[model samples]
Structures are given as C-alpha cells and as structure tokens.
Target: MGEFAQILRAWRDRVRPEDVGLAPGLNRRAPGLRREELALITGVSVDYIVRLEQGRAVNPSPQLLTSLTRALRLNDAERDHLFRVAGAAAPSSGLVPRQVTPSAQRMVDRFRNAPVAVAVHTAIYELVLWNPLWAVLFGDPSSQSRLERNVAWQHFAGSLPVTHTPEDDEAYSRDLVGHIRAASGRYPADPDIPRLIDRLVEASPDFARRWKAGTVGELRTSRKTLHTEQVGDVVVDCDTFSGGPGDQTIVVMTAAPGSEDEQKLDLLRVVGLQRLGS
Candidate 1:
C-alpha cells in the first residue's frame, strides 16, 4: 500500500467504534471501526473505501479527505498530513472550521451513555459528531447526505420531524436564517456558505424572503415536540452552546425532569438503535 493508504488504515484502526456512537459489540476481533462503518460515516461506498485503502484510488478529493479526517477523528496535525499526503492543499485558516477538536469530541464522549441527546454542528450547521442517544432521539444523522446533514438546509428546504406552534415556527425560521446570516459574515472566505445560501434561496421562497429581510440572530434555547415512530411525541428543551473549536455549537436536548417526556427519553436510551420489526 502507498503511504497515504497505510496512514489512512492506521488512523482508521485507532478509532474505536464506541467513540463514534457505534455499539462495541461483543465477539469483535478488531477494536477499531470496520471499513464499512467508516464508509457509512463518511457517506462513501464500501467499494470506494476499499479502493482507497488498497492504493488504487490516488489523490482523493479534498471533500473525501475532510470526511475521512472527521470519521477517523484525526487531530489537526493529522488532518494536515492527510491532505498533504493526498496531494491536496491543507484547508485554509479562513475557511469555516469544520474539524471537531479533541476537547469537543471528549465532551461528546462524556455524554455517550446519558439520557440527554447531544450533537455537534459546524458553523454552517453541518452535523459533525453525536452520541448514540442522539441517534435514538433524532434518528441517525450519518444516514443523511452531506447537504442533508446541514441543519439549516433541513429546516428551510426540508421538513423537521419536530412539531412547532405557528408562532414558534415563524420565530424559529427567522432564528435559523439569522444564524445562517451570521455564519456567512463569520466565514466570508468559505465557499460552502454561499453555495448553501444560494441553494436555500432557490429552493425555499420562505428562505429567500427571510434572507432578503436580513434576519441575523444566533440559535438560542427553544422547545420543540419531536415525533418519532418509536417514541411518538417527545417535548424536548433544546439548547445550543459554544463548545467546539471555532464556530461549532454543541446542541443538547433534554426533557423536563420527573415528567413523562423524561421517562420516554430514558426509555429511548434503553431501546438504543434497535429497529422494531413491523
């Protein structure tokens, strides 16, 4: 294998399955994530991963490199090395910082077994890291496409699983647009931000109107009723914190203590990622 392939494999072998919200099942041979698991997280095909690891795929795209770096939980230096080895320029400092720092990752890891749902998002709302309980509560984000992984795009162009009052919905729409606007200002050198805005403006007239209206606000604490087939409706208190490196935000969702919602959340933790058969 080439140096790039060897290094990639070694890094992949270092990341445990549990660290990325996968169940560390008993009877496992290797402790690290499987190639298939990495493929799933990076939104790439298993065959592609195989080709890359076999040295058949040379000079992988920066997008793929970034995804791999995140999936393998590479540190900043490792990320730069991955880029350089792959014949791609390292991500510029001016770009919106997407790498979830080790400290931020540890913060997410600490809540792996907690009943509260937690997730980390980039400045532009790209879903980065999340816990198993978050998967149980909000569905598996890894299953979504890159664009689909974006919270802003999902909120404006697509439907959220959560139900909101009309007033709350309006306020939330404005708030989301405001956050996007703020992100655009903060990461002016980022190409993704402009592309995202253009897509949103084209796809949703509401977003276009909001963008034209110049909504500019950050995400704040809010309440929403999340509906899932497994748990029905769960009223969760959503709060965003500046936890990760750069403009990343850690989102935490919790139910009222001693309430039925809280009990349901606990039940979700027990249920885990097991899908019930019809």
Candidate 2:
C-alpha cells in the first residue's frame, strides 16, 4: 500500500463526520472523510483527496501535508503520526480518482453556474466534471503532466497562463496553496507534494519564508484575486460543501457579482478549449 493510503485509512477511521463538526448523515459509503467532506474541512477538492487516500498519487508537499493535518484537526501528536505513515522520504504528488458516483456526478452536473471541483482531504483536487466555462477557465495546461492539472498546482505554480501583474500572481498562489494548508490534518502523507515543497523553497523566497507560517484549520471561505488573461482581475468567493462517500469536499467558487469573473471565465474557457482542441 502507498504511504498515504495507510495514513488515509487512519484518518478515515479516526474521524466521524460529526466529530469534525459536520452534520450526521446516513448515505456515506466510505465510513469517514467522504472525499467531499475531507475536501471541505481540508479546503481541498474531493477528487484530489480521493486519490491520496487510494494511493493513486505518489507524492505531496509538506506544506500541503500540514494543511491536511490542520483540516483534520489532528494535534501535534497525530500530525507526527501521519508523517511517520507517509515514510519521511516519499514523494507527495497524488491525484484523487475521478469516479464520481452516479448521484454525485448528477449533482456536479447540476452545479451549472458554479465553477465547482472536488478534492480529497489530502489536497488532490480533481476536475470531476466542471461547468463548460470552468472547463475552459481551468483548461489543461501544458506545464502539467496529466497529473499536475490539479487546480492547486495550477494557481500556485502560476502556470494557469492568465495574464496579470506579478502582484495578482502572488495572491493567487497564496490562496491556492493556503486552501491546501487549511486542510492539513487529513492528508499528511501525499507522495509528490513533499518534493514540490523542496522545489518551491528552492525557487521562491516568499513561499520559502512563509511555508513554516502556514495557517492550518478546517477550511472556511476566503477571497482570492485572480489574473485571467481576459478578466483583468477578479476576486472570487470560494465556498466549500462537504459530505460524500466520506470525508471529502466539493468546493464551488463564484466570482462576486459585478466582477469581471464572467468575462475571465469566458476567456479561460475559450483558451482552454483551444488547448483541448489541439
């Protein structure tokens, strides 16, 4: 089994939906941390978190681990335990699987106006089925191996290809990464993310300095300034929805009304479609 898988199992078994303050429900199949619930608490997407727990991803970063830890509400003792589970030296890059259940997939489809995505508590955000605009806005980037299309990586790495000042770039990166940080308690042992941490520390002084200061906790809503080539700058409100197979979250983001987000969405969608076209 992958390192994160064991840790994921531990996280799942140790948590009850309501223990983390989620309402109790009767439809859960995975027992704990439905990928969507985990994503909501951890501020990751259900799809991404699912892969981390299932061993689909091989590496995750320490910062992301911290986020998952925070989201899961694990104390320092439990946090350390997760690190041990992931094997101090494994990569932290993992992807949540994309098999949305029939009902869940229908729910995603119904979220037509929302730019929604799902991730696991482990910080794996998968584009289960996004709206048409979202498909374009968060288009597949060449910068990623099929694996790196995870939204968090795109926004943080500043590789989403939106044209904006460096100022916007930094803010986008922070929120993207911060959301992951917020969910640290659940997915402490992702595979490739640890290596990404090493790279970020080596590459960006800003992230290097703030990496240690990451705020960990159950994710709540936050604002992000985005730079879309089409929409100059837009502030988006990210809302999280939890409950699913277990402990996962589906995060739906919408630009505040009157924002250029719609235009930006159109642009991203256009460009993304072009890329997908080629």
Tens-digit lDDT track of model 2 for 1-278: 77668777676666767555466688767666677777775566787777887888756666566556644656545666676665553222333223333344345445543443322222444333344555544553333453465555444444664444476555545655565564443556654556666656676566666677784333455555555556566556666665454235566667655556655654555665466557
- Per-model C-alpha lDDT, please? 0.85, 0.55
Please report the candidate that would top lDDT against the real structure. 1
> How does candidate 1 fare on TM-score?
0.78
List where candidate 2 sits over 4 angstroms from the true fold.
1-104, 112-129, 141-143, 161-185, 223-236, 242-247, 255-278
> Which ten-residue region of model 1 has the weakest summed lDDT?
269-278
Per-residue CA lDDT of model 1 for 197-257, tens digit only, reads: 9999999999999999998988888889989777789999999886347679999999989
lDDT, model 1: 0.85
Clashes of each: 0, 71
Which pairs of residues collide in model 1? Answer: none
CA shift of 117, model 2, Å: 8.3
